[model samples]
Target: MSLFNGTIQALEHSLGYSSAKNRAISSNLANLDTPNYKAKDVTFKNYLAHEFSRPIQAKTTNSRHIGFQGDTQPAGYKTIINQASSYQHNGNNVDVDKEMADLAENQIYYQALVDRISGKFGSLQTALKGGR
Candidate 1:
């Protein structure tokens, strides 16, 4: 059995998802003034659904063994570009207020995951130290 019982793995995935969303939001904000730039969005529910659909029991015992491909990083998260028309005459679709809100929301989510992972490690360290 794994030491974390998959808690760490789930948390890792969550962190990656939050990070990806943050990057997308950042990118949108960064291009807020660039003409013809479209805004991008990353949805957590889609990421989780994609992650859950993968087989969890499969394992590769050797380099030659067949293993699951992809899903290695936040890149696995779906990023949807806003294709609709923009309010700005320059055709930039990014909304400053929305991107700022998303950034704040993602920061909170990312911090919570980091705290959880830190606590998980702390408990492991305590266990390793005989409850000291």
Candidate 2:
């Protein structure tokens, strides 16, 4: 009876993660020249692992609710800052090459998720249309 089931919910969350990564990458790139601006990023492996390990389903009764609540999302996003290493003389840590790579990778990830969701909807449409 639910419109967004587990797989669909997972895809939605994946898209969210990809978007957050994109924003983080942009922020890092934007501060590339700022002195002492440490680069920040949302890690994928750990975040996905944590997301899959939890089985709780969070519900939002109001539009004012912010971010995923309870154990379902476990902080929703964990932004990691690069502090162990610095490559610039001004104490900034933004790695342009890595950020570019991450941006491209995140774009691909977002595209893949969108493709999957589209496929799911296509199947649903076919079913609704009484296709054999």
Candidate 3:
């Protein structure tokens, strides 16, 4: 068992996930008019898996499950592509409004994660300094 806990790890993964989503949204926005450009998306599950090394939907069937420390939820993250079927005249599937909304949401999520991680570190630092 570690001294800190899983909270920091979880927050770090969330930050990474949000950053990835931001990048994906930026890419979609940049290639809005590009022909046949399918918008790529990173699901929340994907980063959850990357963070915890567990599949997001994996159920405990047998005894040899990963991270089977009595935890029930499995873990994994899957990247979805080609979600947009009906494209515009240029065959682009990027939805500007949707992508913008996702971008803003992701930014908020990232900031929250950062703040939590910062607080956790601050607490640890204070502890190290003899609670001064």
Q: TM-score per candidate, in order?
A: 0.78, 0.76, 0.75
TM-score of 2: 0.76
* Inter-residue clash pairs, candidate 2: none
Q: Rate the local accuracy (lDDT) of all candidates.
A: 0.82, 0.82, 0.74
CA lDDT for candidate 3:
0.74
Between candidates 1 and 3, the one scoring higher on lDDT is: 1
Name the TM-score of candidate 1.
0.78
Best by TM-score: 1
> Any runs in candidate 2 off by more than 4 Å, and if so which?
1-5, 45-47, 51-75
Alpha carbon lDDT at 83, candidate 1? 89
- Give the range of the ten consecutive residues with the poorest summed lDDT in model 2: 67-76
Model 3 misplaced stretches (Cα beyond 4 Å): 46-74
Candidate 2 residues 1-132, lDDT tens each? 377466797787778888988989999999999999999988767766686786566666778976454555444566788888788999998889998999998999899999999999998898999985
Ranking by lDDT: 2, 1, 3
lDDT of 1: 0.82
User: Which residue runs of candidate 1 sit more than 4 Å off their true CA positions?
Assistant: 50-76
What is residue 82's positional error in candidate 1, in angstroms? 0.6
